[model samples]
Each structure stands twice: as C-alpha cells, then as structure tokens.
Target: MLIRLAIRDVVLIEALDLDFSAGLGALTGETGAGKSILLDSLGLALGARADSGLVRHGADRAVVTASFDVSEDSVVTGLLADNGLEGEPGEPLIVRRIVKADGGSRASINDQPVSAALLRELGTRLVEIHGQHDDRGLLNARGHRALLDAFGRFDTGPIATTHARWRAAEAALEAARADIETAERDREWLDHAVAELRQLAPEAGEEETLAADRAAMQKGARLAEDLGHVTTHLDGSDGALAGLRQAARRLDRIAHEHEALATALAALDRAVIEASEAEDALAEAGRAMAFEPERLDAIETRLFDLRGIARKHRVQPDQLAALAEELEARLSRIEAGGAGLAALERAVAAARTDYEREAAALSDARAGAALRLDKAVAGELAPLKLDAARFRTAIERLPEAQWGADGRDRVEFLISTNPGAPFAPLVKIASGGELSRFILALKVALAEAAGARTMIFDEIDRGVGGAVASAIGDRLARLSTKAQLLVVTHSPQVAARADRQLLIAKSHDGTVTRTGVRLLDEGERREEIARMLSGAEVTDEARAQAGKLLAA
Candidate 1:
C-alpha cells in the first residue's frame, strides 16, 4: 500500500509531504484547489512525461517521490528484486522522479538510478488509477483474457505447449516438402552424374602414381641406346668376359711349371668368374630396360581421361571419389524423404489434434467464467443506480486466421444502457457517470485478484448525489477492505464515509497562491462537508445535515 507522497516545486505545490494510511481515504476541495496537480505529481513519480511547465516559476526542478510498503513476497518487491533495486529489509520502497526546468527527467528507486521504463513497470504492480480517460487495467481489452483466465483458475500452460508443438511440426513439414521438391527437380541431373562417376571410378592418389610412372618410362625410353651399349660391353663378342676367359686358360696351363705362376693363375680364375656374373646381370638389365609403347599408351590414356573428368566437374582428380560419395548421399536422402513425408504428415495432424483439444477445453472454461462474471457484475448494478443497464462479458470465437497461442476467443466488456438498445463496447456506450459506476462494480467483483496494492479513483462520484453517492461511498469503502483506495471526489457523502479525510485548499500569501493538503479533524470535516452541501454558504442547517450524514 502507498505509505507516503512528497512533492516539491510541482505546479502549485511547494515542499509538500503527505503520509497515507491503509483503507479508504478521500481528497475533497473546491474546484481549482489543485487536486489534479497532486495526482499529476503522483503520476510523475510513476513515470509520466515531464513538462517544464509543471515546475514552480522560481524553482530549477520539480521532484515527486512516492513510497510504498510492500510484503517481501509481493509483486512490487519481486519487481524490485528482478531489477536489482532491492532495498534494506523492512524498509519502504521509494520511487523518486526529478523533472528539471529544461524538460529533462531522471528516475530512481530506493536511491538507485533506474530507467523510466522500469519505474513504469513498477507502477503497474503498485498502483492502478482509474478515471474517465484512463486506459490501464480493465479498460484495455487486451488484459481481459488473462483476467478471465485468472478468474477461472484455468491453466493455459498445456494449450501453449501443444500450440508450440503444432507449430514446430508445421515448420518441419514445410522444410521437408521444400527439400523434396528441390531434389525432385534435380533428379535427372543427379542420376546422370552418378552413372558417369561410377564408370570413371577414380581412386585416391592414382593420378600422382600414374604421372610418376609415365615420367620414369619416358626418361628410360630416352636412355635406351645408352643402356644397350652397357649390356654389349659386358656380353657382346670380344667383350671383357671373353678376353678374361682366354687369359685364365693361359695362366692355368703354366701353373705346374712354377709356384709364382700358380698364384697368378688363381687371381686370373677369380677375375674370369666375376666377369661372367657381371655379363649375366647386364643381360637381365637389358631385358628390363626394353620399353613397351603399349604400356605407356595405356597409362597416358587413363591419366588424360581422369584429368578431363576432374576438369568437367571442377574438382581435383583425387577428389572425384569424394564427390561421387556426396552425390550418392544426397540421392539417398531424397528417397528417404519420400518415405518420411507420410510419417511427418501424420505427426502434423496429431499435433494439431492435441492443440485443438486443449484449446477447446480452455475456451469452454472461459465461457463458464464469463457467465459467472456477468452475473456478479449484474448484482452490483442495482445498488449503483444502474439496474436498468446490462453489463456483459462478451466472448466471441475468433476466425482461424486470427487464432493465437492465448486461445481462440476475443473477450470484451459490453453494455446496453437502455431497453431495446443495442449492446456496444462499454467505453463507447456508457456515459461518464455510468462508466465510473460500472468500473466500480467490476472492481468490486475482481478485488480479490486485482493484484494491485493501491487503487485511486478520480471523481468516481461525479454527477451523482444523494443515495447514489452514498452507495458509491459504500462500494469504495468496501473496496478499501481488499486494497488501499484513494478517491478524489466532491461528494460530501463519500468524504463523510472515509476512514481518513484530507482537504485540498489554496492559501494566498500575497505574493503567491500555494496549494496544500491538511488532515481534517471531525469539526473541520463537518465544516468542509457543510460547505459542499450548501455551496458558498456554511449554514447551521447544512452543518446539522453534515453531522447526520457523518453519523449515518
């Protein structure tokens, strides 16, 4: 609940601090006593736009601070914790906004600098101000669905989960169908590429091996004449082996004639043997070096074909094998997708069925809640001078195209002000007085779950008096039982019913007229009420009536 409000140099107020208590409080004063300015100051603290004109003529800045006492687990405190602005335990949460004369503003919570956006978010949790032009709370139909759901105790989680699953299934099916379509368009090209690659059948490292062999064979062909000469030198007629054999025979014939000739004959025998072995090795090498043109032709042809195919596919010859493998994988996916399509279609249908089942249940729950709500608000109408008017919670099922995760229903408050009158949106069909009374009735119905700590009404009793005004007071007083309520009204009956009353008055100090609020004593309250009852005069009769009204 709001605990304190301090305003400095804002409009007609200068250095004002007002302490607020729980339950119903009333603000009453003559017209132009600056009641609106006080509300505006509170609004400024709640993150409303800053205007330099609101600052006092001689002041550099206008500051407004609103303090709220909230439970540790309350939404306001939760918001503070979420924003890292939590203050010391057992301390009140304070929001201070300073508006400079240049139209620039700064906001803080518990003395920690915060953005205006965060301040506005905190305001929504702390207070709800209702007036003729106000757009927050129940006035905006966007909030009606959640309100109805909250009232019904219907959990929307299951529907949301099913909706998400359905959407995922839809997205997956869309992507799969697109892939299959694209693959089908390229089916012919894939088949032709696969057949050609299969026939070529390129292998890894085959290009380098073939090129090396071809180069070596070409070099050997160039050296064929030289290699043949080496062979002839060892084994041809009159070659080294033939000469060595003759020498060895001569030496062996002279070995029995002398010992010296025997040693020389042994060395000659070894030399002849070595020469014959060399001749045999040379003959073997000659056969190996003999070039085969057909072998070279075959190697050159294979290398050329592989290189040409690689160029056609814009890949290295060694990469041809990998390219073929990738094409085969893609082709296999196309076939697999053809079979997966049927299964995915079934999945999409199942997901949609789950979503619809849950959504239909939620929609039915909303219908039941709306019926109860309409009855509740209708019961409040007679006491509020709106017995002839009908209040309704209109639930319309939206078209499939407009359906959302929230549900398929559009919930709005509708009204009919007269017999045979067509029902229209509440805001459009109701008069200002009727709207305020209708809002009061709705608030009374929803107070248990309103979630706001403070609710303020500006001129809720406007254009109303007598028993109707008293009934409005009764409702406001009752509303205060569930949450803090502050009503700014001209109705003396409303003022008389307040647990606390503050009078707004303009005091002239010759140089300036300043607006201020002061708590009124019983006698002072009577005089104020008397003034309201009798207009410009505070007659004895009015005072008697004021006393009677206060007593009642």
Candidate 2:
C-alpha cells in the first residue's frame, strides 16, 4: 500500500506530505483545490514524464516522493533486489523523483539512484494509477493478455517450461541442419584431402631425421675421394711400411754380431711397428667413409618434399601428423552426415511431439480457467453497474508456427456493452466510463489471483455517479478486504465509503498559495463530501445526506 506521498515545489504544491493507510482512502476538495496536482505529483514519482511547466513559478525544481509498504516476497521487492537496492522484509519502499525547470528528471529507489525507465518498470508492478484519460491501467491492448491470464488464474509454469523445451529443441535442430549443410558443401574437398594425406603417410619428425641423414651422407661423399687417396698411398705396391719392416727384420737377425747394431735395429723395428699401425687405422677410416650417391639423393628428395608440404600447410614438419588426423576426422563426419541428419530429425520430431502434448494440456487447463473466470467476473459485473455488459475471456488457438512463451493460445478480454451489440475487443467496444467499470470489476474478480499487496485506483469513478458511484464504492470496499486500496475520487458516494478520508486543499500564505492534505475527521469528512455533492453551496440537505451516507 502506498504509505506516504510528499510533494515539494510541484506547481501549486509548495510543500505537502500526505500519509496513507490501508483500505479505500478518498481525496476530495473543490474543483481547483489542487486535487489533480496531487495526483500528477504522485504520477511523477511513479516515473511519469516530467514537464517544466509543472515546476512552481518561483522554484527551480519540483520533487515527489512516494513510499509503499509491501510484503517481503512482493514482486516489487524482488525488482529492488535485482537492481541491488537494499530493503528489509516488510519495509517501506520509497520512490523519489526530482524534476527540474529545464524538463530534466532524476529518480531513485530506496535512496539508490536509478534510471527513469527502471523506475517506470518497477512502478507498474507496485502501483496502477488509472484516470479518465490514462488508458494505461486496463484499456491498453498490450496488457490484455496478462489481464486475461490473471483473470483466468492460469498457471504459467508448465507453459513456460514447455516453451523453453520447444525452443531448445528448435535451436538444436537448426544447429544440426547447419552442420549438415556445411559438411555437405565441403564433402568433396575433405575426401580428396584425406586420401592424399593417407597416401603421403606423413610422420612427426621424419623431415628432421631425413635431413640429418642427407647432410651426413653428403659430407661423407665429399671426404670419400680423400679417404681413398690416403688408403692407396699407404697400402700401394711400393709402400714404405713394407720396405721398413723387411729392413728391420734383416737388422734384427744380425743384431747378435754387434751390440751397437742390435740397439739401432730395435729402434728401427719400433718405427716399422708405428707405421704399420698408422696404415691399419687409415684403412678403417676409408671403409667408414664409403657412401652411395644414390641413397644420398633419395634422402635429400624426401626431406625437401616433407619441408615443402609442411610449408604449404603452414605448420611445422612435426605438426603434419596431427593435421592429417584432424582432416581425417572431418572426412569421417562428412561420411556420416546422412546418418547424423536422420538421427537429428528423429530427435526433432520427438521434441515437437513432447512440446505439442504439453501445450495441449496447458491449453486445456487455460480453457477451464477461462470459463471459471468468466463466471467470476460476471458475478462482479452486476455489483459494478455492468449487469448488461458481457465479459468474455476469449482463448483462441494461435498458429503452431507462431507459438511463443505463452503457449499456442492468444487470450484477450472481449466485451459487448449493449444488448444485440456485437462482442468486440474490450478496448474497441467499451466507452471510457464502461472501461473504467469493467477494469474495476476485473480487478475485484482477480484481486486474490493477482498476488498484489496493494491496488490503487485513481478516479476510477470518474464518469459515473448516483447508484453506479455507490456500486463502484461497494466493490472497492470488497476489494480492500483482499488488498489495500487508495482511491482518489470526486464522487460523494465513493468518498463516503472510505475507511479514511483525506481532503486535499490549498492554503494561501499572502504572496503564494500552497497545497496540503489532511486526514478528515468524521465531521470534516461530511463537510468535504457535502462540498463534493453540492459544489460551491453546501446545502443543508446535502450535509444531512452525507451524514446518512457515512453512517451507512
């Protein structure tokens, strides 16, 4: 429920603070006693567009603050929590708006700065202010579906769940189709690439090993001639080592004849042994240096081919094996495309069946709920002076292809104002007065279903008077039993039915006039109601009737 509204420097309202309580509360005053100004200020605080002309003549800015008392689990509280605003369970939520003379406005929720758009969004859930020209509350076409749902008391959970599942299935099917298309487009290229790579049979590090072997073989080829020349020189037919050995053997045999000759022969034998060892080592080197030119050429060719392929593929030679594996996987997917596509189609069909089954169940439930709602709203219509007005909760099947989060049904409130009149859309057939009454009836019927803690009606009795006004008041009082209500009204009957009555009046302080609101006592209320009933002249009869009305 709206607990408090404070206005400062807004038009004629220089400074005003009004405290509101539960149940229907009426605001009554003379024609220009700033009643509209008070409502306008409340609207501004609820995120209505700011106008520079609304600012006081001498003031640079205008401010409006509206405070609401809501439950801990109210949607408004959840919205505040989502926006990171601080509030405790059952705490008063305050929305403040400041409008400047330049037509700029700032808004805040729970003292935390917020955008006007967010304020507007949060405001709609908290308070609904309906006026003669303000078609936002119930006459709006966009809100008809929600209104119907609320009226029908339809449980949206199953529908929402089924819709989400259908969407997921649709998305998966699309992705699968896209994948199949892509694979088909690349099938030929993938097959050729995979076959070529398999034929080449590239291996990691093969290029490096071949290149090393090639280099070593080329170096050996360059040294082969030199090794052969050395071998031939050391072991030729006129070799010096053989001649030295023969001389050493002859000297050693004659060594016993002379001791000095024997010592020289021993040194010559050591020299021959050293030369023979050198020749043997040179022969081993010659054998090790032997190389085949053909083998070297083959290794070089393989190395070049591996390097060229690696470069063409834009990968290191070691990565070729992994790249080939990736290409093979793609080709495999392409080959399995038909089977995978079939599987996806089956899955899509199953998902569609599940969605349709759930949607049909939901539609059946909604149909039952709509029938009950029609009866309930019709019951309320009699008391709200719309006995002849027909209320229809229309639930029609939408195209399956156009199904959405709300399921496959389009729900709307249809009405026929007069007998024999064609039942048309509520917004199209109902006049302003009828619309207000219909909205009140709907609200009264769905009060419990809406789960709203507070329901405010701003001049809902605008175009009605006499018995209709009294009927509207009776329904408001009935609605108050379920949720708190705050009503701004000019009807004496509505004013007389309030548990509390507030009089919005302007007080002149010499140079300027200021607006102020006060809770009227019983006597004060009677006078206020009398003033509303008789306009400028409060007739004795009107005062007496006002008293009788309040007593009743």
The whole-model lDDT of each prediction reads: 0.88, 0.80
Q: Number of clashing residue pairs in every model?
A: 0, 0
- Measured by lDDT, the strongest candidate is 1
RMSD in Å for candidate 2, one decimal? 6.9
Candidate 1 to native Cα RMSD, angstroms = 7.8
* Candidate 2 pairs with clashing backbones: none
lDDT of 1 by residue, 1-552 (tens): 899999999988988999999999999999999999999999889988789999998999999999998864377777788879888889898999999988799999999999999888888778888888787777878888887787777778778888888889989999999988998899999999888988988898999999987887787798888877776776656777777788888877879899989998898889888887877776666565456799989999999999998999899999988999998887887989868888889999999888788888888888999999999889889888999999888899899787778878999988898978988877887888888899999998876654587999999999989999999999898889988899999999999999989999999989998999999999999999999999997899999999998998
lDDT of 2 by residue, 1-552 (tens): 788888899988888888878777777776678888887888898888889899999889999999988764457777877889867665788899999997788899989899999988887887777655666766665666666667666677776776787678768778877876887788887788677778778898888788777766777789888877776666666667767877888887889999999899988988888888999887776555557888877887777777777787898988888999998887776678678778877877887787788788878878887888788889988766788888887788888788877778887778888888988877777777777788888887777666456666767887779988999999888888877777878899998999998888888879888878889898999998888888888999999999989998
Q: Using TM-score as the measure, which candidate wins?
A: 2
Pairs that clash in candidate 1: none
